[model samples]
Target: MAARLPLDLDPPVRQLRALLLGVDDRELIAPTPCPGWSVATLLDHLMSLAEAFTEAARRGADAGGDRPPRPPSAAHLSPHWRSRLPVRLEELATAWHAPVAWRGLARAGGITMPAPEMGVVAANELVMHGWDLARATGQDFAVDPRVLAALVPFLSAAPAEGTPGFLGPRVPIDPEEDEWPRALGLAGRDPAWRPPRSHDVPTVRRGSREQPPAARRA
Candidate 1:
């Protein structure tokens, strides 16, 4: 059999770092497409993820399996988590590259997961929510082809039906393609979207003649 794919941390780490550039204080509190999560809420969740992956990397390498504990309440969800995100990312990245034995593997919660599945897990979060942050802030963004190529398959394995969670609708994804249509389709937006209402869609301008300004008066 062909060897299974090894987890890659460099691309994800680089992507996360890039996403942090020029993020505004106001934008963090702005709403995101992820249901009830604001950009700050999303950041809080990502911060917790950095801690979890870092702890997993450290403890998984040790004998006797010391799993890092999680906070018990949702109240501390935003404040406590986002506060320590950067520190934890620095710590985990340092350990992840060092020489270490890879002894972690297991299955849980219907997903056949490994203890050192930290890299892929982190990659998923950074890739998806990184896009969420981009759209929320109206910033120019593009998923690196390498990152999407790796992640789309992983995401495709989950159910096509929608649930209460933020998985959004399952659009038909060609697991082998490089285009953004597959990803956007899965996320509840069409690639070639034109709003249904005449007032909602943007008008196109051609040649040197500027389109009349959209109505300013209500």
Candidate 2:
């Protein structure tokens, strides 16, 4: 039997739902701190994760086997994501809150782990993605200290390099900074990162030489 999930998981779940509620359709395509992922793309990923973890909590270690590939398009955002995601989020929270859900091993993303540990991973996912959405869409994002504290062990356990799905190298952060910044940095995201301005052009200059007329024209 697995241990019970920590009592503090609900705050991150609630925070994620609140961020989802504030997203507007017009902002779906806005770039987020997550490299190459727009708001809509990130939301799609979040929804898929919620579904996977919810199923894991409901079914123990047998769940999330042979998971379906996530759709590339943001079609899930149609019919208004606000109407859809919050309901799913609520269901996810409710499923994980059941005492039985935390009493055995669970599988998520094809990896089987203790149910209590998976619960912590679920909450971390919510908080991280919530911050991504809020930062991209210009909403105020504040990390729940409980959520941050819960994730510290996981972060500390992560390798200094070679972790898949991270955008860049782990950014070094001062010990005196708040846990929010420390956590983001450990996850290989800069907490102070903002989306590039629309007018900024990415130029590839070879040896500081301008592109030839033919290449430029092409």
Residue 202's lDDT in candidate 2: 49
* Per-residue lDDT of candidate 1, residues 132-182 (tens digit): 766665544567677676666666665566443436677665667546667
Tell me the lDDT of candidate 1: 0.55
TM-score of each: 0.63, 0.82
TM-score of 2: 0.82
Off by over 4 Å in 1: 1-5, 61-84, 98-103, 106-112, 115-118, 162-166, 172-178, 184-218
Report the number of the highest-TM-score candidate: 2
Q: Which stretches of candidate 2 lie over 4 Å from their true place?
A: 1-5, 68-80, 166-168, 199-218
**Cα miss at 158, model 1 (Å)?**
1.1
Residue pairs with backbone atoms closer than 3 Å in model 1 (clashes): none
